[model samples]
Target chain A: MDRNGLEKQCLEVRRLIVKSVYEAGSGHPGGSLSGVELLTTLFENFLKFDPKNPKSDSRDYFILSKGHCAPLLYSIMAFKGYFPVEELKTLRKLGSRLQGHPDALKLPGIEVSTGSLGQGFGVAAGIALSLKIDKKVNKVYALLGDGELQEGTVWETAMAASHFKLDNFCAVIDSNKFQIDGSVETVMGVEPIKQKFESFGWECVQINGHDLKQVDEAYQAFLSHKSGKPFLIVADTLKGKGVSFMENTEKFHGKAPSPEEFEKAMIELGEKAL
Target chain B: MKKYLALREIYGQKLVELGKNDENIFVMDADLSGSTRTVLFKNQFPDRHFNMGIAECNMLLFAAGAAISGKTVFASSFAMFETGRAWEIIRNTIAHDNLNVKIVSTHAGISVGEDGYSHQANEDIALMRAIPNMQVLCPADALETGAMIEYAAETKGPMYIRLSRETFPVLFQEESYSFTPNQAKVLKDGKDVTLIACGRMVDFALEASHKLEDEKISVRVLNASSIKPMDSEAIIESARKTKLIITCEEHSIIGGLGSAVIELLSDSYPVKVIRMGLKDVFGQSGKPQELFKFYELSTEDIIKTVKENLQ
Candidate 1:
């Protein structure tokens, strides 16, 4: 798909994100919306996953390390035909496979179950190591929240990934800046994120997370990396990028949009208010 | 004089043998390869073994990932760190997903000795048993450890094989010994009283039974190695047969084999039960034998408990 087509998909996914969270009555819409373009562009172009055979051994693995953004992941996964797009309505509902957090056992295409933050990245690094040992070229990708970097295990994984020279592993930090408590800067700063990853021996690049072209180029660079080190893409994104009222606010970090706010969010995302 | 062997050393040798046959067998250690003896496997299959540094959480999560990729992974660390520090990771990631990761940890119980309370893992069995889809095993001797490791590799899903830092007297013969999960081994049968024990304490229980025999008291000994899917049938049978039971371990009295036997017998068949272990206390720096005597987990302690309970 061209950049223009990918942008349209992003809009559609953003709409789905709002709708899913709206229907579920609660979710992290801000972080979910922030990761739209990064995930949209990756799924459409970079990620080598098959919708038909979701468990194919040859396929690339994608782990939502920041599992609170399940709304976005579920939307994109649904859009990419892993499951029925209409089933997005079942988000966090009883007996629904769309759990509150990403459960790999309960859902196809989820490589690792990740709700207790920092665990998915560790699992991702391990998968990368496994693939490396088996001499397979399967790439492992993990998307982490900026606030999630506060976990010690993330750094532990980062060090191991680089120490093991896992060039096949790529990690992206969805740096939307707002956590539930407030701004990430105030709630234990993870700034100098690029430098920190670099110090940990990761080949890193910073980009505007919501920019499809930039996200595409960053992934391309990771693909072409010859540093013999793991890759880290520090994406500078906006909390609730597509929506107007919810953008840059911590209120929507976890709270669901009210009926009126949901209508406004849909209108802003170029979708009919349900 | 009985010959004693270290369970961790047997574990390392058995893992190397298993790795030689199965190409997909992988070993991981959290920087304690020397202490845990995974270094032996690392020496042979350097490509398949991973030294995951001192991060137990990362090591377990990594083991889960490796297992997810269809590799049988044996991850090792001290029991305290493996089960305590990385407990939630084991519960949520490994056990919850039912991954094929065998966590064979050493330095379990007060028998860790010299390392003090910080290194001892008196609650590992309890922690592992509480998790769904997790099978907990505490081997009685070198042969059982080797057999349990073999079983863990062949079996699917998460398993925690607890090992002690101290060497134990070998009880089972190599040709005759067979490991079956949830089945207790009857080392001796008597009508007066029953002694159910796990790990190194099994040897002590046998000695206690022999001492009681000299005193004209009949005693039965059951090695309750499989802790999670506990030998409920053997426990109930003993409760019905002997009417008095004493459970012993080198772990805390709160939740190891003692608690497991009591939980099973209390529900299925009620009997007079006395638990002999570290009664909710931390271990200090001492030799394994000294720690056992100081903590009152010695064979003499078992004999005294049986005599007191019988009277």
Candidate 2:
């Protein structure tokens, strides 16, 4: 796909995420918008495995460790044909496979059930280690919410991954700044994110998350580096990336967009017939 | 009934074997290696073993990451310490998502003896059994404990198998005894009444049954090592055949074997069930045998309970 087409798809995902929440009446939109392009790049390029064969042992695994931001992950997986894109509307509804948190038991694309923060890195590290041991070169990707660094277990897992020298693993922290309650700066400063990673012996990279070229380059660069350290990419992102009203706002962290806001978002995304 | 095995010895040996064959099997200790008997694994496979200088939470989370990477990690610590200190990490990191981790905690029940209430973890089963996707095992002896080590290592998801510091007789042979996770073993079956128990309590239950048999009261003794799966089929059948039933364990009556038996029985066939346990009181510092007698967890207590039920 061309760069413009990929960017368009990412914007479309951001709009659909707003719409899904507007329809569901409850969902996380803040981090979802921030992660749209990354998820798009992952589904379209970096991650292996045909969506037709979700359970193939050789497939590269992706875990949205900040799992509450299911809107982005669900959108990407549905678009990638892991499930019916229409089912994305049923997210957080009773009996919907799209639970408030990603359930590996319920969803084919989800590798492990994760909602509580800071622990997915541990699980992803394990999966990466397993792949490496089996001689399968499929990389394991896990995305974390920067606010989740308040959880000590994440750092604990980070140390173990670095100690074991898991180069097959790559973790992306969505530095959207705001958490459920407030901004990470006020809540718990996890700044100097790169230094912390370096202290833990991880290969650290910082980039503008909204820039698709940077996101793509980071992926390619991570692959090329044979450092015996786990790769951590700290992406600086707005809490809500595209829509003006939602940008950097904690109100949209877990709230559904109103019907009026959804219309404006869809229009901004250039959706046709809707 | 006549014999039981101390699980710590077998836990050590089985870990060494697991570490030898599977380089992916990692063992983490929290400076309790000598007490928990995980020293054998550490001695045999130094590379795969880690002692994290008394940091239980780090040990648990690190193990979670290691287990995720395709390593079967056996995390060893004192029963009360690890289960209490690092429970949330264990629940969220390993068990909640169903990571393959073997949580082997020694000094369970009053058997840790002179260490007092702080060291002995009577509530270990209770805490572990509450979590979803976690299987709780309390092996009757060392042979079964060794067998359980391999079983838990092979099984997917989180498993907690309680062990004891004190050594007892080797109940079953290392070569032939079969132990399956969540499957209760019927050691001595009788028609008069049923006595269900786990861990060190199984030994007392057997001894009580022997004494009762001398009085011509045939008591069925079952080793309910698997606490979570509860073996409802065996429990119901036993309840139906034996009109009176008694449950014995080293933990509190609130959430241990006694409570589990009552829950199963009340849900299905209501029967006369008497619970014999620590009765929700904290233990004291003393010799293990003295604590057993003082706390009424001894075989004599079971024998006395059986006689009272008969009357």
Best-performing candidate as measured by DockQ: 1
Docking class of 2: acceptable
Off by over 4 Å in 1: none
- What is candidate 2's lDDT per residue for B2-67, written digit by digit as tens? 454557877888888877788878888988898787899889877677776566776776677566
Model 2 TM-score?
A: 0.90
Model 1, residue A205: displacement in angstroms? 0.5
Put down candidate 2 lDDT per residue, A75-138, tens digits, no spaces.
8888888898899889999999999989877888777777878667667876775566567788
Q: Tens-digit lDDT track for model 1 on B1-311? A: 89999999999999999999999999999999999999999999999999989899999989988988889999999999999999999999999999999999999998888889999888888888889998999999999999999999899989999998888888999888999988898999999999999998999999989988999999999999998898888889999999999999888888778888888887889889999988988889888899999999899998888888888
Superposed by TM-score, candidate 1 places the C-alpha of residue B179 at a distance from the truth, in angstroms, of 0.7
Q: Could you report the DockQ of all the candidates, in the order they appear?
A: 0.81, 0.33
Clashing pairs in 2: A126-B68, A126-B69, A127-B68, A130-B69, B5-B141, B5-B142
After the best TM-score superposition of candidate 1, give how far the Cα of residue A68 lies from its true spot, in angstroms: 1.4
| Per-residue lDDT of B172 in model 1 | 90
